[model samples]
Target: MAVKLATAMALFAVGITTGCQGMSEQATNADSKLDLAVSQALAEKDFRLYYTTGRRPVVPGFEQLAFKELEAQCGVKAMPGTGDTLRSEADKKARSEAYQYAREFNIKMYEACLNRR
Candidate 1:
């Protein structure tokens, strides 16, 4: 009975490790897809269209999944902030800072995903 229990525990550990490896592979693929999307957008000058239409860049589903996985792994907490009603220079500066922070956050998420398992 003890030997059987030990074998079961070993199998469970192997299963978990295999599952993590699969997830890591998927995350790597997701990361590649994100890079491709960014390259395509840059090549197409999508930023200009976004600016004209006031539409933000779309995050692909795989990227979103990878980000979610990274967020879970990193235990990142989101901070909610209130936007200023007036568009003063200070407000604009704050908004710019917020965007920088957002980009940094996403980059971290991507790195985390790529580093998984």
Candidate 2:
């Protein structure tokens, strides 16, 4: 009976290892997708800044600076408080869309990692 139980455990382990052969590629792909999303965000921010003030968004540290301070922190490139603009609203919407995509992809990534056992 003990030998039978050990055999079952060994077979289960081998089955699990065999099942996870493709998991690494899936995770790398998801990480790549996430990186692309971040790049897109950076590009959109750059374009918006250029369209409004002909400059790119500035970051003092690893953290980001807010849009309101752009006029002051970014010098003349960030002048004239535009108040609220159509593009600002559109940009917010687009960012929300990106967030949703990231969330979905991250969930899949999590599931893939969990199943790798």
Candidate 3:
């Protein structure tokens, strides 16, 4: 009986540890996806701006000008980073939603800018 109880407990602990590791991997993947999405959106925006205006997008002052234009014309605000601390599931969800919003907003602004040019 004692051996059986100990074996069962050991298996249970291993299962819990495996489950926790899977959850951590999932969270890391989620964060990576968010970062990739944001990066792609910014790249698209920069490309469109350069194509329309015939100006390089990487100049620091010009980038700030584009951001300010986005703010004024699209009423978009900068999205804040999650910083160094671990985020809860709810926080991750909210950040994902915010990123989606910003991405969509920037795309719309790009369209409007292209149309005006």
Q: Each prediction's Cα lDDT score?
A: 0.48, 0.45, 0.52
Put down candidate 1 lDDT per residue, 24-83, tens digits, no spaces.
997677667656754564455332111000232322222344444544454333323323
Lowest lDDT 10-mer window, candidate 2?
45-54
Per-residue alpha-carbon lDDT of candidate 2 for residues 57-116, written as tens digits (9 for 90 to 100): 332221154645533432212223322333777766754444444345334433333343
Q: Following a full C-alpha superposition, what root-mean-square deviation does model 2 have from the true structure?
A: 15.3
**Which consecutive 10 residues in model 1 have the weakest lDDT in total?**
47-56
Best by TM-score: 1
Residue range 1-117, candidate 3, lDDT tens digits:
999999999999999999999999976876677557656755665433221111332212234456556444433433454233436988767655555544544454456555553
Record all residue pairs in model 3 with backbone atoms less than 3 Å apart, i.e. clashing.
none
Q: Score candidate 2 by TM-score against the native.
A: 0.34
Point to the candidate with the largest lDDT: 3
Residue 20 of model 2 has an lDDT of: 88
Q: Model 3: residues >4 Å from true position, as ranges?
A: 46-117
Clash pairs, candidate 2, are 71-78
